[model samples]
Target: MEPIYKISTKKIRLLLAAVVIPCLIISITRLYYCDKVEYVRPLALEGEMQLRNDRFGDGHYAARRAGGKRHAGVDILADLDTPVIAIRGGRARALIDEDGFGNYIIITHWDETKSLYGHLSRVLLPPLGFVRQGDVIGEVGKTGNANYKSMKAHMHFEIRRKGKTIDPTFIMEAENIKK
Candidate 1:
C-alpha cells in the first residue's frame, strides 16, 4: 500500500463552530452590560411620599449669582431616620461631613459617575475603607447647614458627570426610571 492519508473535514468544522459560537455569545453579552448604570431611588416614606426637593424642582436647577447653579442631584424622600442605600455597584470613594451637605457618602459606579448621598443623619462606615452596591451608606436626617428641615428629611442624591453637577433627573431617565 502507498501512504495512507486522511483528513476529517467534519471534525475541523465542528471545532471551528464550537469556538465561534461561544465567542459570539460572550461579545453580545458584554455589550449588553458593560458600564451600564443602574440605580434605585432612595427609600420612600413608607412607600407613600415620592422623592422631591424645593431647592431644585424636578429637571430644573437653582439659579446662582456666580453662574447658573445647575441642580446636580435627585432628592429621594424618606423618613427622618430611613436608611440610604447605594443605587449602583461600586466602591466608596469618600464620606465627608460638611456644612452644606452635612454627612454624605460618595459611591463610585462602574461608569465613573459618583453618586453622592447627602444630608444624612448618620453614616455607617465599612471598615473605614470599603463599600459596595446596596450597602447602607447612612440614615436620612436634617443635618446640613442647608434648610433640610423645611424641605423634609430625605436623601439628597447627586450624580456628578466629569466633576460637574448636571441635573440628576437626566441620569434617572437614562437609567429608565420615572421621576
Candidate 2:
C-alpha cells in the first residue's frame, strides 16, 4: 500500500526555516511595539520636544528647582497655541486649576497610565470626554505659573502611574531626534 500523505524530509526542513522561523521573529518584535510601559510620543506630528539639560528650569525631567524641589514634568517650549496631541487613546478630563497648571487635560490611557498636558492655551475636549491616539487635545501656551514673565510659552507634559509622577521619556521619544 502507498503512503496516503507523502512528505519529504527536505520539505519539512524548508517549512520550518522559511515560515516558522520568520513568524517567531515577527512575534517577538511585535512584543516590543505593543509594550504598555513604553508607548508613543505626545507631540509626534507637530514636531520634536526639546529636552534641555540645564540648571535653570529647563524641559528636562526631574529638573531641580529652588528649595530642594524637583520638577514633576518636562516643560516643552513651543510657539503659543502650537497643537498638542494625545499619545494614546483613553478617557479625558479637561480642567482649569488657575494656579500651577492653569488649563490642562488629563488622559487616562488604555494602560491606565495618565498623561497630563498642562499650561495649555486652549482645551478642545469637554470636561469629560474620550480621545483617540494622536488626537488634538489642546494647544501649548503659558498659563498658571507658566504665565510668569520669565517663563516661555510651553506645554507642561507629565506622565503619572498610580498617582506618582514618572518620566515621560521612558515611553515617549522625540520624533525628530537627530540620531
Candidate 3:
C-alpha cells in the first residue's frame, strides 16, 4: 500500500517571501527616516527656562504653589498671541474654555500619551480635530490662573500618560531655536 500525500518546498518559500519581504522593507524605511521625526515647542522662547519662583510655580515642574499645592507642568513664557504648536501627532480630545485653565485643548497622541496646551489666547483647531506634529493649535496667552496684568504672557504645557502628568522635558525640545 502507498500513502496519498504531497508536500512542496517551493510553495512554502514563496509564501514566506511574500509576507517577510514587505515587513523587512517597512522596518528599514522607518529606521532610515527616524531622524526626520521631531517634537515641536509649544511656542517660541528667547532664553533658557530659568528655575524661578513666579510664585504660582511659574515655569518649574513640581515647584511650590500657593496653598501648598504642587505644579504639575512647565510654563513657557512668551509674547501674547504667539503661535502654539502641537508637540506630536494626535487628535484633539477635548476643547475647554473655563476659569481654571482659561482656554485649553487636550490632545491624545499616537503613543497613548496626552498633552494639554493651556492658557491659550485663542484655539485654532476645529471641533472634529486631528492634528499632526508641529501644527498650530493655539496662541500663548495669560489665562486660567495666569490672567493678571502683572503676569507675563505664557502657556501651561503638560504631557500626561495614564491620566497622570509627566514632565514634558523628557521628550520636548527645551530651546525654541531662532530660525
Candidate 4:
C-alpha cells in the first residue's frame, strides 16, 4: 500500500486567508495614497508662468483668503492679459463678474469635473458656451482679491469634482507645464 497524506479543508482555507488578507490591505493602501497618472497639463505656458501655490495637503501650500477662510485652488503667476486656455474640453457653465472672483468662467468637463478660471481680464465665451481642450477662454488679470495695486498679476486656477475643490496640480503637474 502507498502512503497517503491529506490536509483538512479548514486548514487550507486558513492558509489562503492569511495570504489574501495582507494583499487586500496593501492594495487598498496603494490605491488611496498613490499618485494618479491620468491627467494632462492645463496649458502650454510653462515657461511663461510659475506656480504660486499648490493644493491643500501634506508638504503642500495652504490656500487661504481674507477673514481666515481656506482657499480651494492653486494660483498660477502670469502676466496680465496672458491668454488662459481650457485645461480640458468642457461646457462654459458660468461667466460672471463679481467682487470676489471679478470676471470668472466655470467649465463643466465631460468627466463631470469642473474648472474655474478666476481673476480674468476678459471672458471670451458667453454663458453655456462649449469649448475644446486648449482653447482660449480668457486673459489673466488682477481682479477680485488680486486687484490690489501691490499684488502681482496672475490667474487663480482651480479644479473641482462634484463642486468640491481639488488640487489642480494633481490634474496637471506644475513642473510639466508645456513650453
Q: What TM-score, over all chains together, does every model reach?
A: 0.61, 0.68, 0.70, 0.65
Candidate scoring better on TM-score of 1 and 3? 3
Candidate 3, residue 169: how far the Cα is off, in Å: 2.1
Clashes of 4: 1
Residue 160, candidate 1: Cα error in Å is 1.0
Candidate 4 matches the true fold with a TM-score of: 0.65
lDDT of 4 by residue, 53-73 (tens): 423212123555556867677
Over 4 Å off, model 3: 1-38, 45-52, 172-179
Q: What lDDT does the true structure give each of the candidates? A: 0.60, 0.72, 0.70, 0.66
Candidate that would win on TM-score: 3
Q: Please provide, for model 1 over 1-179, each residue's C-alpha lDDT reduced to its tens digit, 9 standing for 90 to 100.
A: 76597658998897788677632222322221122235554443343335564654442334342254555665666778887767665556545566667888787555667778788888875664345545577788876744434677667777776897666655444544322
Write one digit per residue (lDDT tens) for candidate 3, span 17-136: 867753222232121111124566666555454332564455777777778887788877778898888776667754556667788888876556788988898899855677766778
In model 4, which regions exceed 4 Å deviation? Answer: 1-40, 53-61, 126-128, 174-179
State residue 83's C-alpha deviation in candidate 2, in Å: 0.6
What global local distance difference test value does model 1 have? Answer: 0.60
- TM-score head-to-head 2 vs 3, winner: 3
Give the alpha carbon lDDT tens digit for every residue of 45-138 in model 2: 4444576343347677887777888889888767788888877667788889887899999987655688999999999874448676666788
Q: Comparing 1 and 2 by lDDT, which wins?
A: 2
Candidates ranked by TM-score: 3, 2, 4, 1
The clash numbers for all candidates, in the given order, read: 0, 0, 0, 1
